[model samples]
Target: MAKAQDKEAKAAAKKARKQASKERRQQLWQAFQMQRKEDKRLIPYMVGLFVLIVAIFVGLGLLFGSVWLLLPLGIVLGLLAAFILFGRRVQRTVYTRAEGQPGAAGWALGNMRGQWRVKQAVSGNAHLDAVHRVIGKPGVILVGEGSATRVKPLLAQEKKKAARVVGDTPIYEIVVGNDDGQIPLNKLERHINKLPKNIDGKRMETLEGRLSALGGRNPQGPGMPKGPMPGNAKVRGMQRTARRKG
Candidate 1:
């Protein structure tokens, strides 16, 4: 009976994995279609990289008199390089489109991978300007999106609130935009990742617990959409697939 149960569990797990793979492939294909419309050079760049990598490998194989042995390896590497290029182009296109949209910073933060915790629209106003809070190894981060004029105040208020609860924990403030001293939406993730680590996993958890009492402001505040930006549903799926495969 135990053997039969184990076999069934293995089969179910395999089926679930296959289903996930299928979904990922579909999402990637959709992303490719959307990206190619705006990214004319994407294909050319991928093809060029693939050809260049394969040519270099072939040349080395010939020099070593192992053309047959290296040919397969070269082909595999070339394909991987091309796929990486495709994924990068898709990501660029997505970020470009998402930039400046309401809650774009929150959307980006929500997708970040790691031990970070994101709270979107922690403080927002009628104009859709909002501040998002992120807690990670680097401590607390308050990211504001929308008009600089309004977001600045929102960031300040939220930072003050967070400081009250976080004590000595570091609190970083960032405004997402193209303006001087502001992090662009596409580079927001990288900027956050570069912050100096100020806490460990246990410390982070304690910080989070303390801040939890602060809670988030009304998410349904004026002009805030309850879900992702319009037309972003498909793009969101593609983003996940690209992150996994990239």
Candidate 2:
């Protein structure tokens, strides 16, 4: 009986150890994946970073071969690595915190692969929210993810904005959710991409010409209501919309 009890205790310890090891490995994997994902230009960027770092150190080391510069430089490099690590940690934390929240779609869409004009929170009401429009071949797509009763009105307002520039361009509106009338959050982008392209260069050029006057405004408000701020439009085609709320 004592021997069986001891065996069970050993087994439990081993199991716990295995679990800890697995968890550590999973954390490392997640960290690595996050780093890789955020840095699509990983190789070149890192190489450039490393080269610059090495050059600085080489010059500094030559200038002051004494312990003071070397030690300080080592500390700086260590801190830089820590900063990179911390940045990724912050990003993952922000993402984890945003999961299942109201405006998660904004985060996902802003992080897409192309030059999309994402105007966020174009219109919002007590019960619904509307993301503003414009895209490349994708044309105008109003994305609403809130109560259907409220979203419809939000959609109408957004549609009106699109029509002013979209003219006869193919326009689509979709609500993000699993409800009977909504598109699931995960499928939102795929559905948008899968839609037929509606605008030609001539029309797109004309649309841009019309909307050019509307680009001087700021897209980001104080803090975005419930989810991610559209980051890429600043880098991508997301210029400011001229319209402002009174």
Candidate 3:
């Protein structure tokens, strides 16, 4: 009787998970539809991707004389291509919306893969200009967003404070914007990823601990949300879908 009851409970849990997954997919589909209304190129891009994949696979099959074997492979590749293109579009849309918004730099850092520790709104002023700090294998990275003239001083001050605590640890600075000498919002993640990894995992943990002791923004100052901003849920949804598909 105990075993039978256990099986029933397991079945119920499985059914609940299936329902949750179905709902999530429905939500993603609805989000995609709404995005398509603004992204006029989405359908055309998918159609072009399908046509290109079919052409390449059909050509290879003709040369190999394995048309049947390659036909299904072609369909699979086409679908994968469509999915990737969709993800890219979603990412672009997210960045476009996030650009110039307060806390966007922190949001981007939070979404990055790996073991980096992010502290949002470490320093800011009434103008909405802010500095966010990230601790990773590369050491401390200070990212500033908002007016270059104002943010330069904020980043400098934060760097000095961080330097006092993390002696000899390499500190890299980045400004997020489209202006000269600034990294574009879309390329921010790639830029950080390319930085030289100066420290190992153990050292990274040590550095994170030291910075944590320094604490974050002043309790009296305004704070930006640590997660992605509103209307950017679709980007997170796309990331989830890609992870599951992978």
Candidate 4:
């Protein structure tokens, strides 16, 4: 009886994994279809990369008199290279589309994977400009997105509020834009991650708890969508999938 139960459990787990795999593939297909509509060069670039990688490997194989042995490896590596290229292109496309939109910085911050405790739209105004709060090893990061002129005051205001609660915890303010002093939306995550680690995990948690008392603002500016714009969230998922599967 135990053996039968164990077998059934194994089968169920396998089935679940298969279902998840199927769903992931479907999501990828959907993303590819969506991206292809706007990015005509995606397939061509992928194919070109695959061919280039394979040709290089084949050349090396010929030089070493091991064409047959290296051929399969080459094909496998070529496919991987192509997939990674696809992922990068998808990521770029998503960032490009999402950039400059109201709450875009919050959306990007919310998507970051880490020990970060992110609160989006912590402060904003009627113009849809927003300040997002992030707490991590680097302490507090206030990322503002929207009109550069409008966002500066919001960042400063939010920074003051954050300082009142965070005390001496290192607080960093960033504006997302293409301007000289601002960080681009795509590079936002990298920039934040590179900041000096000023606190430990325990301190970060304590900081988060303290900041929670400060509450947050949800400015539903006219015409501001409640979540990421259509297709933006889906593409972000595809970007993660690409990074993992590639």
> Which candidate's lDDT is highest?
1
Q: Across residues 212-239, which tens digit of lDDT does each residue of candidate 4 receive?
A: 8887675445544434653556777777
Which ranking of candidates, highest TM-score first?
1, 3, 4, 2
lDDT of 2 by residue, 13-77 (tens): 99999997786556545544555565566445545665566567767877877656675675567
lDDT of each: 0.85, 0.58, 0.83, 0.83
> Ten residues in a row with the worst lDDT in model 2?
237-246
Model 3 ranges with Cα > 4 A deviation: 218-221, 225-246
- Pairs in steric clash, model 3: none
Q: Per-residue lDDT for 1-246 in model 1, tens only? A: 999999999999999999988988888888888778878998898889888888888999999999888888888999999998888777777787788778888888988878898878888888888888899999999998888988898888888888888889999999999999899988999999999999999988888788788876745458554335536677776677788998
TM-score-superior candidate, 1 or 2: 1
Candidate 1: which pairs clash?
none
Model 4: runs farther than 4 Å from truth?
1-3, 218-226, 231-237
TM-score of each: 0.93, 0.48, 0.89, 0.89
Cα displacement (angstroms), candidate 4, residue 181, comes to 1.1
